[model samples]
Target: MEKLYNKYEVYNRWLQDSDGYWQEFIEKTAGYIYWAKKPEKIFEWNPPNPFKWFVGGYTNAGYSAVDYKLGRFGDKTAYIYINPEASVERRITYGELYQLVCRISAALRAFGVKKGDTILVYMPNSIEAVAVLLAAARIGAVSSTVFAGFSPKAVADRIELVEPKIIFTQDYSLRRGRRIALKENIDEALKLSTWRPQAVVVKRALGEEKEPPMERGRDMWLEEFLEMGKHGNCTPEFVESNEPLFVLPTSGTTAKPKPVVHVHGGYQVWIVHGALLVYGLSSDDVIFNTSDIGWIVGQSYIVFAPTIMGTTSILFDGAIDYPKPDLFWEIIEKYKPTLIWTSPTAARMLMRLGVSHARRHDLSSVKRVVTAGEVLNPEVWRWLYEEAFQKNVPVIDHWWQTELGGPAIGYYYALVKDMPVGLEFMEIKPGSAGVPLPGVEVEVVDERGNAVSAGQKGTLVLKRPFPGMTPTLWKDHKRYMAEYWERYEGKLVYYTGDAAYIDDEGYVWFGGRADEVIKIAGHRIGTIEVESALLTHPAVAEAAVVGVPDPIRGEAIAAFVVLKPSWRPTEELRKELIEHVRKTFGPIAVFAGLEFVNMLPKTRSGKIMRRVLKRLWTGEPIGDISTIEDEASVEEIREAISRLKVVKVSE
Candidate 1:
């Protein structure tokens, strides 16, 4: 393993080799993990499901993340919990975190959860909720976490699929100086869901005694739940390598949430290796990944990877804009972390808030910056790197998805490191997502399924399945195959659904999602949800939604709506629709673009061309539309967009 670091070229060769490259690292990294049964085979490749890494291995993700590092790093702060809106701060050590997880694991079994059972964790970004995730993992019970910002309809959609034994939540959450009722939302979700959970474990956010309205038998306080396993002597369940550790919801081709299953063995190995290679994780460093606990970035970077590496991480529990726009900077100054990972949406918002907030704080501790979730525009990148960080550190952008459990492409280390000549890698590219990380093989493919030349734009595809990628969509293998593998004719290549290209020098650049799943402020929003919300409006007859460029949010939900017979489009109507989406989607959807149109442009096949709508809104050239059902419909959209441009200029 040491010898492989001789030349950076050697690592590249391993990636090129692709045969046994990952197995070696997987085996080497497994030595650090606490495995109940060591694997005889490093990997096995079977299509559709695609992989079984560390085959024959029996391990627990929570043990690897917490108990494995307890002896060496127990005294160190594993996480610094801060809720800016609540004005509360606390710290937990690895040993303490391990104890808490043990209690939760026992309570889970008391509540009838077992290996292969699933739980829905719909709580705020608190240490308690994070403990629930680890607790589920400790007992080999799969946990599916939902962003607390989502509405009951969103939660019910996931609940119908998961049919979990327990629904983990809290009394309330604080954000933007408001207390959101989490327990109330859970109750509403239970009403909406067809499948009912056995138990709803509620954490009292106010205090232990300040309880909310609890059901007689179904609801229980987290305190009493922990008391069930108060002995702290619970044994962990060692699930097989392919056993799911957690399920994260991502927007698929339709409105239904696609459960992305990530297993314990490969997931643990990938993040451990990735934390070192990509983010330069070390026991001496503190990392701050600003993604919410619901997202993969937060799960991998903030919780599992950093904790498993025996490093401290800042577990932020509120929005950065809450108390002050400088809340992020304030956290950095107070608790100095060495590495920081956030989304470009957050960076763009901070830029709009002014640099004075950052100037007042100490930022020398952040040696490097990593941004993902969406493409970082060159202007925003330069502003963040030059003006914000003051050119003191490298501002790097990496690329991955909810499907990819870890980063697939990023710099060797965003910070400078001392290594032999062979260990050094390429320089930073402003808009590029760096070179491929150690485990993946990425290529650009033309529509005909041929590999494109360097610098040629085409659909980005993975040549082979990697350890970091999701094993399969949860319970929907057919849809997974059709959506990812069946994109091309019979190549079996993994379609990323992103328009991208590789540079001549081997750097990857993304041109956003080729699919209609638009990302607003780093959260994925299916266009179908936006359209459905619009159609529910009394005055709306039909609607089409697309993502358009937004200075602060990476994209805004641009909706083109056709009105009913008696209802005419008015300024008040537009405002009503905007508020409707925000309320319906529970604050995640920013419906900024509302245009009145007679009809929406659709293809002859009856599919809405969201890309065409996006182009018209962005003023990009409308390419060959011969397949369009009606040319007059497109003309109307063009006129609507022109009026929007005029409104923008006037403002």
Candidate 2:
């Protein structure tokens, strides 16, 4: 592949002359999106805290995503939805989507929803869920979507924070052929919450579960809600660029999850630019994003990015291995998507099924494959490349967080002008998230706020604000500053809370979360490095490492692994895995204990919750397991720990 832009030149310019580079980059990328009002200033930064982007602009994200594409591509398919059972598929066009959004917005207005009011959506990955989000955006209402998997208490916490005026939910959701009563959960949450919001329910699974009794005056069916909108006139509300667009709750190690707020003007600009530059999306492309609408990736890629670019987005409402291990490959053959993005967890899960499942289907239409949400270990990355993709596509690993809103570092195919239309256009670096995107400043720094040299691990920080960066926490500006800004007080930087290192080639290597870094004796080791080493062994399928208190060493490394189906939990295999890591990373990375388990505890977005593992190991109270996909896995780990014998170490 030929180089589009000189990586060194761009990095040097960003380090030395940021203002000039950012100005040019902004001016160039801003032309890609339609802005109702051009901003007088590209960006403005305040001391210690406040930051704004695209000042003095007026735009609505819903309009740019739906209405802007209707004239040119009214009949073009905007979204393709597959039902939970995979028995039915539906295609929706831009014109149809626009009308649905407008009608829903009008209905929300009739139910007392207005500009600046918040609306909560609690539904599965269905067409109604997408419409509710767009409807809220159309009326300038802040949409807060809680993952349908959350418990009543988890949903109630977020509902209390926003106190939304109206809530949208479904009667039931289907998962792996099991029916989940979503309406019952919503009712339980409403009982816990003090505010009584109007509810609109969708009949997702008509016969699976009995319909919960609805409140006489507080609830209505989705069909009746649309009928209410038909009698009223509704129009898209164009607000200031910095108005709140949505509030997404991100889980931490603490008991209370933090709600991150993103706005219209800057978020829209960043999503559109990301779709073009990072994903290389065009009108002819169809993107299959294997994420739920509740997560940040689903909201950005599945809804906002592709819609703004006038491309087709795919939404699958079932597990990847529900019917069979090759269900995802079946989707690729049916939709012929040009791009596929999903979490590393899914890749590892599919790896356990072996390559035969994927080989049964043809994946000729997939041009690019990407993974996020967690570190893409070299083991799974190579398997996906050689076995799943047959070395024909680019397996790109990007890095971002829920707070960042979008990818900050990755291979950008559209970085330079006049590039080819294949995987060769983008460079792939194994085990590294590619260079920073244009106009984004990322640096690895030590605790003293000084930049670190190559191969040295430290905290990753963004030196300047980007268009998509979150302005503040929802109604908690002080906490936002305390968490993100206080660490770099004198310097104007945003702490990313991730530990990483920049290689000599300017690529970023994610170590792990700063809080999850395991320190043994005086040596600091990232759990990801140890976990990745274990994954290299043929027997290990998925692994998670945590630091546990030791009588001699300050802390010792404890590993929990899920083995492939062919391998069984035996003392010999455990010792061999420990030796593998010791040989790969030297004795400093040797595990004090290893337990073979069925699965690792992970969030709904597919991020391994190492904190839960550490808490479970040290006999501490597990804070929140609401976002966990399978709660049974936590108990499996507990039983495995009791059976495994610890490796004694000399002081």
Candidate 3:
């Protein structure tokens, strides 16, 4: 079961016959779902359009996630909703959820929703929120779910994209026991939007959750909407496989938002494959993902992937460390999930609180841990794999982007057991993303689109199209071409906008964004290298690095570090950290200054916003703070940088 070389040979064959490889998925999917019409062809290679799969075929993505599992997993628990802030746990079966999807889709169609229409889901992590997505995809309508933590303006920015015919939202969202007025935000967002939707459906709270006053004709209560659509047609729409399933906005530090569109056939094909191949999902396993429906992970892993595979997904609705620092462990002891998918930021958050509270609860239930949303630093991976799980489970680190519908590069955790002899001997690199996924051709290329030598840092580009890879941006085909495909002179190569290097063993190591690399003296350094090195230090709980203009070295590294709760920031500790980086990261890493802060700026999806740090360091105006997870972190980091106007270096 460990033939690593044999697996490589299998992967090479898959690359040789890419379309035939996806045909295998088509055959497997056909057994579960009833396709309205069989596809005339398996695929068509054309860019600047949706990734074509099952060309000329008709199927509904939602049907695969819900309908197909009805007979087989009808009474089985499809989802478990756990909200610690509200102190609630609710399990919904396929039959019960099927009814909701029927009623909701009926309601949507009754309220003038139809094929090709777009709707916005501005709600928290709950069964109803995910149901709305399923219902939308069940029909031909496209649904876009926004993060609950986004501001009114941020929501409005996405609202302006499709001018959704209907917005599915909630009365309020509970976060760390704090009430966020979601309905009020939607009302304000509608005013900012130019297109007027026919109706806004609001799902109220549970237990003492009185229905809020509606805006007359503009808003409809969830119960009332369900009643209205009760008699409407609930039959799944016969949508072409290549039709747009949903649109997810890019929430990075970009100057403007580019909503990425995912189609029915290609999206489902890869999400289902990745959930099984990448994460090893099955009906016997329970996956607890600490992500929200606002991002791609939430849509694919939390909602689509598990249900499509007839597995139970633990839907976490509130903060990971909220109510108590040991909330994650409490859930683990209670539910005994087989797999845990989370972010490096969340893991570091728990790691910062120390293990005293975690040790009190049993963590033996987890079989594997997977991390993304930034490179999983070796320090965090080792802690989770060794100290937390006692090295009983593998802490896997995979890489992907929102533009990619599913995982592009990941180790085959689910299929690894069946791998041939040499495969088990393939040692896991704690820091590197395993390898290019099936039928995905990845290479580190220089500026001119030529492959670079192994271990040499360069741009990461996909030489050809993969099923799950985004065909184009939501409505801006020209901009999509300019942003991703045009960077390499419009040669059809997908520019990942990431700086990475593939080792001789074929593992991908992502340093950071291409724009985030720092030039010191005559050497270039990725900020991730400095941050990862800092994380290895005992006192450093979380660290973020950015390059600032330096008179002496062109660019120098400035680090913002958050020490563990037991450790306090001091001049002596700061000097020691500088020396530690000098020794570990080598003297090539020229330090401009190191600032101790209580927190680091991050997006709602848990990605550190290093650009904000660079802006704050130079006394420049930080742009577009809408997606900031914690606003206080920005101000705190800003104040710390004000005292660091004079660069201190060379310990």
Highest-lDDT candidate: 1
Q: After superposition, how far is residue 533 of candidate 3 from its true place, in Å?
A: 33
Per-candidate RMSD, Å? 3.2, 11.5, 11.3
Score candidate 3 by lDDT.
Answer: 0.79
Residues 115-166 of candidate 3: C-alpha lDDT, one tens digit per residue: 9999998887899899999999998899988777666656777888877988
| Backbone Cα, N, C clashes tallied per candidate | 3, 0, 11
Tens digits of per-residue lDDT for model 2, 341-363: 98776887788888988898889
Ordered by TM-score, highest first, the candidates read 1, 3, 2
The estimated TM-scores of all candidates read 0.94, 0.79, 0.79
Off by over 4 Å in 2: 1-5, 8-32, 84-86, 415-426, 487-489, 516-651
Q: Can you write out model 1's per-residue Cα lDDT over 329-436, one digit (the tens) per residue?
A: 988998998888899999988889988999999999988888999998888889888988999988888899989888788878732232211255457888888777
Q: Give the TM-score of candidate 3.
A: 0.79
